[model samples]
Structures are given as structure tokens and as C-alpha cells.
Target: MSSAKRILLTTISASPRENVNYQFNNQVAIASQAPVALIKLLPIHELPDKVIILCTQKLYDEQYETVRNLLLEYYDQILCNTLNQRPDVTEVRIPDGRTVEELWQILEAVLHSIPHNCELTLDVTHGYRSFPFLYFTAALFLKALRGVQIKAVYYAMLESEETEKPIIDLSLLLDMVEWFYATRIFHHTGQASPLCELLRPLETPPAGVTGKDNAPYQLVKSIRRALENVSAAYAQALPLELGREAEQLLRRITQPIPRHMEQKVPLATELFGSISSFAGSFALPATRQRRIRIKEVELNLSELTRQSSIIDSYLKQGYVNYALGMIREWMVSCAMWNQMAEESIYRVDWWIGHKRFETEHKFAVLARTAYKADGNTTRDIITPEQRWLASKWQFFSDKRNQLAHHGFRYEYVLHSPQQIDEIRAQWEELKSFVSSKPHWNLEIKRGQGTLLLSPLGLSKGLLFSALHHIRPDEVFVVTSEESAISIEEITNRADWSGRKYVYKMKEPFTGFAEAKTISRELQNYILKSDRIIANITGGTTAMQYVIQQVTQDLRLTGIETEIIAIVDRRTPAEQVETPYVPGEIIYIEGQGRLNPPPND
Candidate 1:
């Protein structure tokens, strides 16, 4: 077979808006040269069969179209001028968008259109957001093209002030790619190995062989042996000098053969060894072998506790780190909210003094310290409040922890009913408080008292008092009972003097007659007076009749009257005070005096 290779080259054109496009262009050209030189330096290279060139579509619109056209125009001239040989090339276009899904779809479409055997080259210097896409695409490509050799070129642009040359280390990147490929290969090939059979007992053992049988015991040993071999081989292939370290790790892991081996040979041997010693010392039936087996199983469990403790410590440390991370996230979320709500204008000194932001910074230190304390096992350290707060910040932290440590999958973390209720209550309280209307000096009183007359037009009666702050020139009194106090008596008693009085008959009248009477009475009385008082607090009909009469009179004559509602005092031998105290009413000099309560 010809030792031919496939190569992919990518170049990113800098935008005109970029601060140093000239420098970027030179860097890209240099980066482009270095990869081609590296490929030529490879020992077993017949020239590459297929080459793919990747570039941003944005570059085509902004800068590279002219360059591309020039290259096509002077293709032979460029080849003669340049040191490196140019290979057959296919251009792959990367789309522009803020969303990963959009970019992913565009990339997927582009890759789908390309021939299956071709390798991918990514140019990712423009923006950091492209890194995830590039990594994911490369990983996927490696998975799809299993046997194909892949190479990566990383470019770091240098500043003029820096004399140190920019270095691109492709070793780690290449190692990662190779590891992914190897893992895929191992996963596929491992399916056919005896290791797969060892794993099978973990899923489903043979029908006759109960879990207590020697079959499971044997399977554990077999699995441990296979895992050790694979791990040793993998370590031997590692490029690192610490193959001894890898072997040590494999040895340590292999020391604990999982107690549940398919065949119970080790367990049976231990049990029989113990029983044989006791055979001379004690009397026991042959049928008691099952009892001895049970005893052996119990002994295995006691030993497992030691192994489980090691696993638990690791798990606990992981949980602690997880919890601390959640706490840090929550603190960030709260700080962001506080900043947004307060416009970052206020509370700077408070935030600095209290160190709310600084507290979150300590998470890194605390996480590391806790991890170390828990024997580098995050699962062992329990960050109780941190985990709780993490759940508060994002409901997934606790659920994620359980899955990580406990291997639980089905249960999901969600807001508890109590948490929901508390949140709802707080929201309702805030809504009510924010939306409530302001109440001015308006006051409502509920009591029986004498109506006192004040310059503010307050009436102090035997049972109640009212302040008619709005005054009228003429007084209208419409009462059903003639025995009730007259308008003159009320006005005189309340010291409402010089106010005109108009009386109407208690009976209803014809429309025009009623209208004329109302007009004539209001015009005659109000034209000469300064205030009009209407009292209508009694039985329902009496109040209604008085209201209608006063309303018609005022509407016809355009007189604004101060109406006082009055209810009669029914209790006897007990003096009823007005609801309003005399001191509560302020009277101007010319305004009438508000009568005080009668001294008993």
C-alpha cells in the first residue's frame, strides 16, 4: 500500500474592523506554512490524497473573496513563488450566528455535503465561542472516520512588544483526539472479548447458578484480571514516561477482586478451611454446609465495608465540590439580581464592606480544602447548607449530587410544596403592598353622638356630630313629622344664623308644579344667603323625601348646599354625646360656633 496521507488546512481572514488585520494576515500565512511544513516533515508521506480547507463565510463577504480570486487567477504564479506544495482542496463554510444550535446545524449540513473519507480542518482564531463547536465537530468527525489519521494546528497571534516567539503545542490536542479514537476502538473490540462475559454475570447470570454460587465469585476474579490486563496494555502504550505509575494504579485496582465472583471457589476454600479445623473440635452434620456458606457470605460483607468506605470517601468529596459550586453560582445569581434591581448605583459601599461578592470568591478555596480533607473524594464531604443553597439557586444541584453519588436516575429535584407556598405568599404580599392606594386626610367615624355646630360647619346633636366643610347659603328642611325640630330650631341650636330657609310641603306634587316650587323657593332663598344646610337623617322615607326635595331645589337654582345627615336619639335618661368632639372641629372667626355637649 502507498504510504499516502490526507491533510486539512484552515485559514481565518481578519476583519477590516479588527485593530491589527495586517498583523493577523501575516500570522495566518505563517500558521498556514507551519502545518504544511510539518506534514512534509512526516517520514512516510506520499503527498496527501485529499485536503479540506475551512473558513468562515463572514471572511468571504468581508476580506477573502479578492484573495481567493487572486489565488485562482495566479495559481501557477503562487505555486512557483511559494516554498510548499499545494494539494487538492475543498472549501468548507462556517455560518455566523450567536446560538450554538444554529452554528451546529450549519456545520452538520456542511460536513454532510462533504465526502465521507475527507478529514476536517478548523480555523478558530476569530472568537472563543467557536471553540466548543470546533471541539465537538472534531470529536464527531474522529468517531465517524475511525481509521483516518487526524492532525490539529493551533495558532497564537503575537504582539510586537513580546520578543518571545508564540508557541503552539499540538501534543495535548493530538493526545486527546487519539484517546477518543482509542476509546471507541476499545469499546467496539472489547465487545468480543471474555471481559464482555465477565460483565454479563453482573447483568444476568446462568439460571442454575444463584448469586450465592461460585459462578459469580469466579466472574469477579475474571473481570478483575481482564480489566488489569487491558489497563496494563493501555498504560504501556501511553506516551508519558510514567508507565510505572499507570501499572501501580492498575495493580491497586486489581487487588480488590469484587466479592461477587461467578464461581465461589475462593469463598468455598476459606469456608472449608475453617470448617475442617472445627471438624475435630465440634459436632456438626454434613447438611450444615449451607449454614457455613451463609457464614462465609457474612464475612465477605464485613470485608466489603472497608472497600466501601474508600469509595464513600471519594463520593463524599465530589458531593462537597458540587455543593460549593452550587453555592458560588447562587451567590452570583443573587449579586446579579441585586445589581439589576438597584442599578449598581447604590449600595456599593455596603457590598464592599459586607464582602457579599468576596464570600463567593472563597468557594474555590473551600472546595479545594474540603476535597483534600475528604481524601480527594468529593463524595465524602457533606456540604449541607451549600448544597441546600445550590438547590435554591438552580433546582438541579441536589438531584445531580444524588445521581453522582447514589447512582439514582429516576428521581428529579423540584421545588417542594412548602417552598412553593412560601414563594406564593411573599409574591402576594409584595403585590398588595406595591399596588395599594394612598389614603389622604379623609376619616370615617362610627358612633352615636350629639351634633355639634362649629365654624367649620360641624353639627353637634344629642347623638352624633358631623362637619359639613362645604357650606351653603340657604337651608332646606323637609320632614314627615311636624313634631320634629324645625329648621329654625336646628339652625338656632347649632348657631347657624343669617342662613335663608325654604320649606316645601311633605306631599309629592305634579311635575311642573313641583319644578316651579323648587325653582322659586331656591331662587328666593339662595340669592340672598351665604350657606344652605339640608338635614335628612331619620326614617328611610323621611330621609329619601328630604334628599329628593333638596336635590331638585339645588339642581334648579344652581345652589351648592352643605347637607348634614341626622338620626334621632332613641335612648332615654342617658345623655348621648356626638361622635365628633368639639375640639376636633376648627371654626373660622366669621363662621358659626359649633355647639358643645350639654353638661349633665
Candidate 2:
């Protein structure tokens, strides 16, 4: 019944097969000739490569010899074997599964009987009461933990001598169970790859599978990329587009599946509610979204409240490390917002413009000071409730640093985790305090328009074409020393004249941390909610990646940002009538339209 190298697992039944006649496809295996009806299901006179017989002491003592003789007689006579080669059968001893301990022993025996990650075929035709359940449970364990693939599970029904019994393939039931776990994982972690794989088979109908059977696969395929994008947003800790991305996934799943589909497809349809629920968890209110669309969101109260909701989600889902770092950084951001609120505009302007690093270092120091100091020393920059939140940051700050520098935190004598109720109360209080605070969002004057951030790569034509197409008022360039040989060629162009330019020179190589550090600095030059375009079409692979991530983060910092990679063509062509057509501009972050080059 099994293919080469596939293990067939079955058990010996004490029931009298002597009176039974199992017939299928003009092949019959009588109870007198065969130990089990499983022999009848073999594919056209073929023996299994390996057979694992689940045996118990009482069962073995009574039926072992009879079963052995019947199998040999059937294989020798019916199979017409001349070489005398038999299936490599192994009888493994197991408990009878009467008590709890015996059931555990039976489960362990089933696991020990198989090779790791092997292809398996199971026959439950002659199992005892708990035997089938125990074996099936073991199969699920092997699948989830050991990467084993269960090829088939079959049960042969016995009814009458003249009747042909049906062999029910229960493999579909097992697949549904796996899909259940995968869907739950997607719910908890926002990861969709597992469910995506299970649904991949349904993408195109199998040979015999057609019509409504393909509905779930089509539904999943449409949203597969969106699902992964939402997962990536969560995994990367970028909340700027998380709500929108989650909504996209939710919308796609809400698309109606064909009615009365198969079992596996229904499981996906049933998951629509959970998808909507989890996606709603990351949603921002219309007011906040509108405020985001306008100016003055940077270091803003509403945006911080939105982030707290995401942190709340992580906490509820038991992602402490993710919530931990985000919580402490929230404190730094709150302190900067506080500083901007308390200090004058001139001081803020001078601090941020002349000493950018010093400005960031000062805000970090102020946050720490505000956290440690409870008196009037920080009252100018931090409110009393804000100080309390800052104190909460104190706890996460240590935990975050400890996680980064050391391993797990060891709890010694007189150490215990905070009470669950106490933690919940603190989080609720923090959320309430952050939500009630006023926003110190700054407004930009007119004429402060678009800013273009592009990496300096080879091909001045590419950058120049982008400038005219994007038509930004200011430009921020990240150029490697090697690419700067012809830097002046693009810098001195009359087409790009009347715009201010600032260049960052670095080694040809840029690491992730380095790129992230530099990307954050762009926030200074960013006007209030100004349109920022990150042209990643030019730069190293590392630059392209981190810039997208940082620009997404920039959106959370109260600026409008989009990531686009421009290319001449997907497939290169030799002759182009328009060399500076600017090719294709693909938006990586949010929706954006490609502009045609400017005219006289």
C-alpha cells in the first residue's frame, strides 16, 4: 500500500478476519488468506517497502503467528513472487493504552517506531479503541515538530461477504487540522506563510478538482503578497503602514468564497472573522488618519496614542521583547515632544539645525533625567503623569538594554514578576495619560514643498530624470566616494537649479545600522508633513532596503513619505527614442503616481 521508502504503520486486530472477504478492483484477500484487509488495497500486486506493526504483549501472544502466516501465504501465492523478497516488516512493542500512563507509552512507542521526517502511510482498519487516536496524534507531532509528511491515512470498512468495502482516505482531515494550526499562528504572530503554503495546492485545481473547489486558493493567492507585506511591517516594527496593510489583508479575505466549497476551503472561509478581528486591532481612527494626512503630527500626541495601541497589541499577544524596546523609545519621543512644547521655537530651531546629533543626544538625556527625577527639576519638560510614564520607561529601558547586551534576565531571591493586575493597571494608566496629552505639532510655512532623498549611484541621467519627474524643492543625497567622481555633473545641472542640495559622503559600502542612522537625520530637513520621496532606484542593496524601512518610520515621525524604485525597463531594450523617459516608478510604501518630466 506504500511507495518505496514510505513506512506503512498498522496494528494487529484480534477480531476474527476468518469470516471476512475483502474485494476490490478484481482482487480479493480473504480473512483466511490475509492477516488484514490492508493487503487488498495494495496497488496491483505490490508489497510495501517497509511495514511497521504496532504490537502489544497480549495481542502478540494470541495473534502474531496467525497474522505472520496469513501475510506470507497471501504475498507468496497471490503476488506470484519468485525471488522470495518480503516487505521489511518490524514489530514494535507498545502498551495497550488502558490508563493515562499506558496511553503516553503508546504515543512514545509510535514516535520511536518511525524515522525522523519520513513519508508515512497509516492503516487504522484493525486498531483498538485508543490505538488510532494515539497514532494519529503522533503523526501530527511528527509533522509539526519533526517536519514529517503524512502521505495517507486509510480505514477499510467491513460489512458483508458479497459487498465491496470502502477505503476512506482520511488524509484530508489531517490536512484540515494542519491548516487550523497555521491559521491560528497567522492570527497570533501576523505571519501568513504557513497558511499560504497549505492554500498553494488550491491555487490551481488538481486534475480531478475543478469548479468551486478552487475558490479558496484563488482568494488566498490574490492577497498572498499583501499578507506578507503586513507580516513584514509587524516583523520590522514599522507601524506607519501597518494599519493600512492589515486593512488590505482584511479586505481581500472578506471577498466572498464560492458557496459550498470543499472542507479545506471552508476552513479558510471560517477564518475570515479572525482576520478581520486581528486587522482591526491595528487600525487607527479616522481623526488620527486625517491628522496624519495634514501637518503637525511629528512628536505628536495622536500618533503616540496610535503606537501605544500597537504596543498594547504586542503585550496582549505576549510579545514582550517587541513591546519592550518600542515602549522605551516611546518615552524618548514623548520627551522630545515635551521639549518642543516647553522650550521656545528659536532654541528648538537652533538646537536642531546647528547641532543635529547634539539635539538628539540632548533629548535622550532629558528623557532619562525625566525618568530618574521625580521633583521639579524636570517639571519644565515633563508633566507629572508624563514622569510616571517615564518611570515605566525606566523599567523597560533596563530590560531592553539587558536584552541587547546580556541574555535572559535571571530572577534571584526576593525577585518576582509584577502582578498581572498591577501590570495591566499601569498600561491602562499609561495609555490614558498619553491619549489625553496635547499635541505640540509644528506647522510649516508655504513654499516649503517636496524633498527628494536619493542615493548617488552611477548614471547621472537616471538621477537627473528623477529630479525633473519628482520636481522637489530640496534634495538630500547619499553618495558613496566611488560614485562621486561625476557627482558635479548632476549637481551643477541647470534643470535641477534653484534647489538646495546636501550631500553625505561615505565609503562605497553601507551597513544597515549606518543607513538607519543617516535616514533618521533626514527628519531635520523634512518640513511639517512635507512630501518626501525616497528614490531607492540608485544605491547599494543595503541602501535600498534600509531607506524603505526608515521612510516608513519617517511617516510615523509626522511626515509624508513614499519609497519608489525607478528603472528604465523590466527587460532591457537597445534602442529607446526617449532616453530620459524615467522608465517605471514603482511605489514601495504607499500609493503614488509617476509624474511626467517638466516642460519649458
Candidate 3:
């Protein structure tokens, strides 16, 4: 029993263009081959049982009246005349095409009208510029949020220059979006499974590139092999083996393609490029060998994420020894590298500073001292809860060291599962503690503190407000290459102690791809942070968007993060009569606050 009902959704246009007139004059046969265009273009099996027209009041009454009459005529006389009934034609009222809020409302109304078990077909034949985009996004939203199956999305190809009227299937765009997401999964996990699944989609490349001898076709096949090799390398933690295969694959990618096939390939080129960029990092030197003191020579955010992901894969597959060592190394790096920068001063003695710290324990002690001295009181910086977490991490480190130096004992290898599980659980708790809000003290000041400012949009308010809320130990101002001057000035003007480090983004943080890249650049700083407070009030929309996403991603890994937009509200007349009362500060936590403080 097929429960699918076909519903056609389209907007009515006010303009009396050639395509509109052509559509109206010929209700049954817009083309010579078929009597009815909608019936001919849409798959016969998926033809609409109901037609929905979205139109503004002005267009519905004046312009859409003619189109509606034509549809009604076709339905009553041509489509269902022999059946003795007319197909349902629903006219959904929409606001005049101007605001995005109006567009959202229109989408909601269309969604509300849709039946539970139905297949959707959208028509972009005659509509405004934003119509197709809005409708497409709505379809995606529905598919994700409501489990709606989008059978097809259509846009009739009728440019003024083109003589033939053809229907263009827009469903392929959504498929490409899915492919991008799949590739992103592969990039993040370094697992060949997701990329291998993409082969099914690439078998039918966009623009009909079905040539077996095509360079892109061959490239994708080669990439599948490369992914397999890289996956194996990750499984074994053999960087050399991965680098050998990756560099060879990269060589094949950069090698001159056939002149004829270059222009024909669109989707394949993008897929290959993304894969190449992700794979290129595997060729880099080991994290241990990389310079921690030199800012530019450090392992980037993406590399760290990949390394962490690789460790997770090892743990999942029961590579307990390898996972433990990697975890210990990363934890040490997080501590010592954090001490390398002044703004990130937390544990190391600010007075004594970093002195080629050989052991992770010494680094921890120094970090503790810095945190203790951050305030006026001589009280311990770490809470008892935090001390417990530290103790657990130390235990994990001890076990890792025993395995490394004394070789694997019976207990280490025999009861590995229980030990690994404990280590993993404690590692998560330690990470949460390290990045939790409790480790970070909130400093209230009028101006000046350690600021992680992004000066993309040339705004100083965010920096000032952020400093006022939390007076950091050191400031790290981040800026795009384009806005480096602006961030430099802010860094110089601010009366923060010690060196002012400015990190530059290679590109604009506008899209998902760019955001991922930007997130990598800010990883170290974010990990060192007790809290990630994203000031979306400043910077370009892209910059603000990526920061919010990065912070959210951090929160997923048990880190505390917040998004704050500074609001400059004028005091009300009645309030202005009284003495000055500053803006009220609000605090919210993932866990509810304790009703009564625990007696220590």
C-alpha cells in the first residue's frame, strides 16, 4: 500500500513575462510533444494529487487569477473530467514579497498544509529571485526536521535567450549538499567508510559526465584507494605509510588532466580538492617534533582535531596502549604549550615563567600557581572537585608511563578494557575541568584585560565589553588577513601586560568550509580557555558565525561556552531620574545552581 500523496508547491508571479504568457495560453500543451506540461515534466507516478499556489494578496486577486483559472480549467476539463472530479487547488495566503520573516511565515503555512505521508514537488517556473532559494531551503528543512520525502524539486528552464522550454531538476543540489557533509565526516574521522559511500552518488556525476575514460571518474576511483590506505595508516598510527600514499595521491591529483575532461568535471574537482587538502596534513611531521614555542611552526587546529579523532578511533578499536600514550602526550602538550603563551597563563608561575619545562607535573604546578595568584587572595586556585580530576589524570599518566618504560605487564594487557574505559572516562572529566568555568575567574573592570578579539568588522565594543566582564591574564587578538591592521591597533592600544599575540585567519569565515578551517586556527586558544564567550556583536557575519559554531563544537566535548551580544540600551526616562544603575549581569549554567551550598 503506497501511502505517498504528491503535492505541488509553487509561487505566483505578478509579472506578465513571455514564459508566464506561454504557460497561460497553452494550459495543456506548452511543448509540442506533450499536451500538459506539468504532467509531462513530472514523473507520471509522482504527479500531484493536490496543487498549492503561494501568492501575495495583490497578485492573487489581480495577476494570479488568470493562472488559477487556467489550472482549474486543465484540472476539471483535461486531467479529471472523465473521473468527474477536480483536483484540490489550495491557495495559501502569503505576505507581499519583501521581508525574510514573511518568507518564513509562508514556508510555515506550506509546511502546515502538507499531509503526514506525502512526496513534495516544488515548481520554480515563475517566481521572484528569492523564491527558488527559499523553497529549496524549506524543502531541506522539512526533510531534516519533519522526515518529509522530497521526491523532486523542479525549475522550468526558460531564459529569454533560450528558445526551448525544458524542466531542470533541482533535487541534485540537495544531493551535492549531502555529499559535502559525507566528505566532511570522512575528513573529520579519517574513516574511508563515508567517502566510499560517496561513490554511489558520484557514479552519476552532475552535467552527465558518464564517460568512463574521464579524468574525474578516474580521479575519484584513485581517491577511494587513497582513502583506504590512509584509513589503514590511521588504524596502525603509521604516519609514514599514510604520508607516502597521500603524497603519491596528491601528485596524481596535481598531474595535468586531459584538456577535454577538465571543463566537463564540476563536482568531482571540488570533491577531489577537499580530499587533497585534508589528506595533505597527514604528510606533516609528528606533533612531538613540531615546535611548540614558535607560533607559526605549531600544529594547527585541524591537525589537533584530527589527532584527537585518530586517538578516539584507536580507543574505540581497543588499541589501549596507543590510545593511552597519545592521550598522555596530548594532555602534556595542552599544559606545557599553554604555558608558552602569556595570555594563556593559568598554571605556570608568571614570575618564574617557562624554563624549558621537561616534565608535565612541573608544568601543572606552575599553572596552578598562576591561577592562584590571578586573584588578590592567597586561597588555592583549584577547587577540591578540580583537584580530584587532576588526581585522576595523574593516575592515567602513571599507568601510561609504566606501560611505556617497564613494558606491558600482565595487568596492563590482561584487564585492558576496564583500564581503558576508566582512562577514557577520567580523560573526559579532566578535559571538562580544564575547560570548565570554575577554573576561569570572571573579572569585572571598566577596561583592559586578556582579550581574544576578532577585529574583522573593526568593532572595539566587543573587546571592551568582553574585558569588562572577564579580565583575562593575557589577550590574544585574532583577525583576518584583511583586517590585521585593525586588530594590531587594538592590541597596541590595550594596556594589557606582556606580549600581544595576533593570529590571522587565512580566509574569510563565511561558509562551512571556511568555518572549519578557522576553527582549527583557534583550537589551542579555545582548549586553554576556561570559557568561550563568543562576541557576535563585532566582526563580519561569517566571522561571528564560525566563532559561534566553534564554541558550540567545544561545548559538545564538555567545554563550557557562551554567546553574548552587547546591547547598548538608553536608560528609560523614569530610571534616568534616579542614581546610576548599570546593566544587570545574568548567569546561566548547564546544571542548575545548588539550592544550599555544600558544607565542606
| Model 2 poorest ten-residue lDDT run | 438-447
| Clash tally, candidates in order | 55, 0, 9
lDDT over C-alpha atoms for residue 405 of model 2:
49
Q: lDDT for every model?
A: 0.37, 0.62, 0.55
Candidate closer to the true structure by lDDT (higher is better), 1 or 3: 3
The C-alpha stretches of model 3 lying farther than 4 A from their native spots are 1-3, 17-28, 31-43, 63-69, 75-87, 114-118, 149-152, 157-159, 162-166, 188-198, 204-265, 283-325, 329-600
Compared with the true structure, what per-residue lDDT tens digits does model 3 show for residues 1-600? 457777888765565544321232233235321113565444345657788888788868875667666666666655553653565776888876588897788778877877665788787766678777778777877776776778767766556454545566678787677667767766666666756655634434457566665556666566567677777776666533565566555766665554444443337577767877767765533344333222232433343454565566566666666777777655555444433445554433321213223434333443433344344432344455444535655676677776676565555444456766887787665555443433322111112222243334555445544444444554455456766665544433443343345656555564545666555545434434454455555566666676666665545444455555554354545333531222322333232121221131
TM-score for candidate 2: 0.58
Instruction: Give the Å shift of residue 68 in candidate 3.
Output: 4.2
Best by TM-score: 2
Can you tell me which runs of candidate 1 are displaced by over 4 Å?
1-5, 16-51, 55-58, 65-86, 113-122, 126-128, 144-147, 159-167, 174-249, 252-600
- Residue 346 displacement (Å), model 2: 25
lDDT of 1 by residue, 193-265 (tens): 3333324445454567675675545644454454444444332322111122223223333344445431422
Of 2 and 3, the candidate ranking higher by lDDT: 2
Best by lDDT: 2
- Candidates in order, TM-scores: namely 0.28, 0.58, 0.41
lDDT at position 118, candidate 2: 73
lDDT of 2 at 468: 63
